[model samples]
Target: MSIELKHLRYADAAIQHGSFRKAADALGLKQSNLSRGIRTLEERLGYRLFERSNGGVQPTLAGRDFLQSARRILSDLQTIVGAANAVARGTAGRLRLGFYTSLSAGNLRNTLCDYARRFPDVHISALEDARSRLFADLRSGALDIAIVTGEPGAEFGTSMALWSERILIALPDSHSLAAKDALTWADLKRERFVLSLRDPGPEIEAILIAKLVTPGESLDVDHHDVSAESLKSLVSAGRGITVVCESCMGSVPSGMVFREARDGNGSTRVGFCAYWMPANENAALRNFVQMLEERCPPLQP
Candidate 1:
């Protein structure tokens, strides 16, 4: 037999009040209507739910067991309704954010914290990856939105550039260059450098080769989630100095100091850009993109 929520609610109310008249009054239904509804429910279930008594009514054994189940069903229904409303209002849902290694500790961290404070119901998950992997994920639907460094000739569905900062030289506190207020690319011509293998894309490698002297030997680190943190540790131990985005200075090891590269103007600047599939735009994702644009204006592409 088909059971409806209305039937369950009426049964729960009747059992709670323990009388047809009281149940009807509470439910804003006439006593006769309430009586007939209960009678129909019992008939459909093929059992007598209540036993008529001299005082009024009492639940039968079957009725007693069914009352708890009925109440539980009604409670569950109410919870489902509440959750549905919350989702419909865009006040609750999950957001997956993809970010490159560099931004994870700087602007992205701050932006996510602010978003969480304002919308506590929204669940946010951050995934850190290299720029190439992040771009692939964004195109394949693996990421909702991603923060990546912009490429000059690459095509994207939709994107907004967030921040642009000149690359700075990270040197150990004891390094000779640390005493200098600022550095030029030529200043590091003879220094051993700790470089991430992933830092040199076709475009960036050309720039780096043009500026710094080829090191006799170097540490080739895998560029991943913990790569930057590990690189900072190496610099702190006085292993070598590396060039990184100026924003990364805030997160580098305590003993490390960052200096602006004097020739940084024409150098590759790190930028944060958000990209998503153009055809898959939803209200929440759209709002998030709009928020990024408002917070950080895009550079001319």
Candidate 2:
């Protein structure tokens, strides 16, 4: 039978009060209407739900079993409604996050840990990839947010400057320049610069060329399409020296040493930005971004 939810609720109320008159009073329903509703329900189920007498009404033996099911169904429906409301309010749901390679230990890690602690109900799944892939997934709606180095395109989504990293020179431990207290861009002349052919690679190359290599000077640079681990391996084997951020120094291979790059000024800097679709409706993303803004300092240009 196509029994409605209101019928189930009326059945539960009647059973709880054990009297049609009392249930109707509590529910703001008239006694006759409540009694008629219960009678209709019992008829649909082909069973008597209550034993009526001058002592008022009580569940028939079969009615008790049916009432138990009714109570559970009503409670479960309420729970379902509550969960839907939470999702609509952006307080719960899955968050698909993407980040650039070698980002697991720095700002991204701190932001993720803090987000998990504050919003335990929000499920977060992350992917690490190059910038091209990250932005591709972001545009296709497969990714909700992306943490990438350099500026994100306007077509990709709304971008917020998140954090910056200081450029450091990575040198072989046995290299002559490694013995120096500090090194400058001018010292890098004739040095083979090894970089990964990845998203941030081009960005980093531009920065290094601008800051270290003088105009009209040719730089010996190598770009490899490989993972971060493989990149470090190449540097450790004396393939060439490369530049990296202070944040990435922790993950540098054992044979590689990091040196401050003094460009006659201070540290040369690279920036990272958070990208999200302006139309994204995920509530978890809202909470995550809010938490990030609260916990992280604003990006200085």
Candidate 3:
């Protein structure tokens, strides 16, 4: 049918104003154009929309039903348009983020809080998984972004250098090591260590072996299958000492204390980076990346 949205608008305006002349004035259109549009709309529906009146226009019983449907359609169209505009501006829609870091307190946590504050309408879906699974999700388009530790080797595609966090040792309150405000790798040489086989655990183990392992000396370390949360509880119960990132300090267990892990270089740390596909065109992802770049810019060479 040749009937268009303008015809529907014209009909609705005329009904609200109760006069073709007033509707045209309100719509900023010529009265003749408004009248013609209403006529076209009525003709399309094969019905008389208005009963002629000397004072003002009024909808016929049938026209009242038609106008009711027309007003609902107009309202729905307005909502659709508003949502579309918000999505285009990156102020709405969904953003799926993958990570393997503690959100207790860190740059990642701060960034998430700020982004949520700025774009409250945008839904943030976060997933914490092993590094390999995170990489796989990013590759399969299941995740828009993945924040990982160590380096910028986010295999699927583009990567950006983010902030690095200082490593810390989680010691029980009664442990003699807890007396030290900061500790060096050498201080942990004789202590028993407990680590999970999960993400940061494996990554932390690698650092431990690199720093402490030597030809003639052996360090005592045990591995378990548990989550970061459970690992902290185990340490609090004096199961064994464990290493953690600075973010873990935010919500340390009641019986545990976090001490800076250092070496000859001062504070031992692991760098973090963000990885995402360059081809993905999610507006929310784009906005998130912009915010990340602004807050944790890469070191300039």
Candidate 4:
């Protein structure tokens, strides 16, 4: 005969009340049924559990040990059930996230904070890397989602437009352009630019070419093997101006300032998108994607 959860539960209740009648009333069972369950449990273990007394019932020395073990078993089973329920509800699990943008400040940073607060049980593993690698990781199942600059195209996976941030020009405090309230793309044409030799650096170079590149003239831009922040540091030292997204404005190095880069329409803004595998079935990923959709809905045509 196998000992079941109900049998252990019955034994524990009887021990707690020290009476079959009281335990049966507490468990909403008939006294005779409670007594028989206890008797069957004792038979399974080949030992007497409770001794009938004038007080109603009391545990034998062997019954005391069985009750103690039964209580522990019940506690562990409760923990297991709770954890499984949390996973089933998508509230508890691991989320592997990939992003290339700086979270110094902006929508990306705010979204992360909101997600953490809303789903405390989700263990978020945030990985910062280049765009190509983020896509590679997503395809390999190493990442659940990736947020990056520009439309991630159809080949990466499913993509959604999430948010957009202004493209700002970083200039030295003493630069003449600092005196202006804002700057136009034409204003940046004659200026020397210092850019990173990284993922966004290439993107920035492309923008500079499209916006400020004059026919039959080369752009005076220096490519530095450094991070975006380091590129800003170069601008702070008056080496040359650089461009960064508005989100990066939070941590601009001292002596440097940011100006909104504008075109004929308005501020030059970079759009960001989220990418994930079409076949990814991670519940945690689904929850995060849903949160993004609610916070940053698709723009109207």
Alpha-carbon local distance difference test for all models:
0.71, 0.81, 0.89, 0.89
Root-mean-square deviation of each candidate, in angstroms? 5.0, 2.9, 1.8, 2.3
> Which window of 10 residues has the lowest lDDT sum in candidate 4?
148-157
Across residues 47-141, which tens digit of lDDT does each residue of candidate 2 receive?
99899987788898999998998899999999999999888776677899997647536677778887888777778988888777887888888
By TM-score, highest first, what's the ranking?
Answer: 3, 4, 2, 1
Instruction: Work out the TM-score per prediction.
Output: 0.74, 0.85, 0.93, 0.90
Q: Please give, for residues 1-301, the per-residue lDDT of candidate 3 as tens digits.
A: 6769988898899899999889999999999998888888888889899886777789999999988998999999999999999998899999999998789998889999999998999999999999899988988999999998978862569998899899988889999989999998888888888998999888898898888889887768888888777788899999899988887777878998888988778899899899999998999999999999899876779
Backbone clashes in each candidate structure, one number apiece? 0, 1, 0, 0
RMSD of 1: 5.0
Q: After superposition, how far is residue 49 of candidate 4 from its true place, in Å?
A: 2.3
Candidate topping TM-score: 3
| TM-score winner, 3 or 4 | 3
> Model 4 clash pairs?
none
Instruction: Tell me the tens digit of each residue's lDDT in model 1 across 1-301.
Output: 8876676777788788888788889999898887888888899899999997757678899999988888888888899999877766656776778864565356766777777776688787777777678778878877788776654334777776677667677889888888998887778777766666553233233455666636664323223223666777878887777767655756868788888777746644666567777886444566566667777865566
lDDT per residue as tens, model 4, 155-246: 75799988899999999999999999899998887899998887678888889899987789888989898888788889999999998988
The CA lDDT at 120 in model 1 is 83
lDDT of 1: 0.71
